[model samples]
Target: MANKLSQLDQVFAALADPTRRAIVMRLCAGEASVGELADPFAMALPSFMKHIHVLETSGLVQSEKSGRVRTCRLSPDALLGAEDWFQQQRAIWEARLDRFEAYVMKLKKEKEQAAAKRPSRTARKKGS
Candidate 1:
């Protein structure tokens, strides 16, 4: 779990930059060449390439160069660690919620049972 958390941290930190997020979003649709990825950012090719480097280092993206062009693609495996971390968090939260719900239901049932045990005014009058 600790390792998973660390990996999640790396993944999210890498994505914290707008350029990196944009790159990821672009890759979500399909793989693209570096030039194509850089086209919309209005940044120099070198600067944009740095963003790709960060993404690749964080394991969120993969790149391959063929001839003069470099193409990048999203790596689905990179998300697995983050997803595991989230699932652990969710499981803990759900367990707590479930316990709370059970406690509330138990209290409600106890209250109803107590109310049933109380003598009615008619019963009190008859006893008197």
Candidate 2:
């Protein structure tokens, strides 16, 4: 559906940035405050916040603020659409490759059969 594809597009787009991807990776272990997440990067808080914003917009991350601290966590559901798309593509390619392999094997067998039916050069020379 269009909605699914749109979500997939957003997820992929968000993940396209290394910073955003790293943020997601860090969240995988557990949720962390915005300051903790930004510690590993060399950029300023505002710059890092932009990456967080993109992830939040893409639905790949969820953040909540309590007091002065903002904590972010990964939203696993956002990735499901992308995962399903990849699985579908893998299945289709696997099927096509299997068919191609079968066709190649059939051709090889037919070639061998034709070769077996032909007379050898040695046989022709002996006949002559």
Which digits, one per residue and each the tens of the lDDT, describe model 1 over residues 63-121? 99999999999997998887887898999999999999999999999999998999988
User: What TM-score does candidate 1 get on C-alpha atoms?
Assistant: 0.80
lDDT of each: 0.91, 0.96
> What are the TM-scores, per candidate, against the unseen true structure?
0.80, 0.96
Which candidate should be chosen as best, given lDDT against the real structure? 2
Residue 46 lDDT in candidate 2:
97
- Candidate 2, residues 9-49, lDDT tens digits: the string is 99999999999999999999999999999999999999999
In model 1, pairs of residues that clash are none
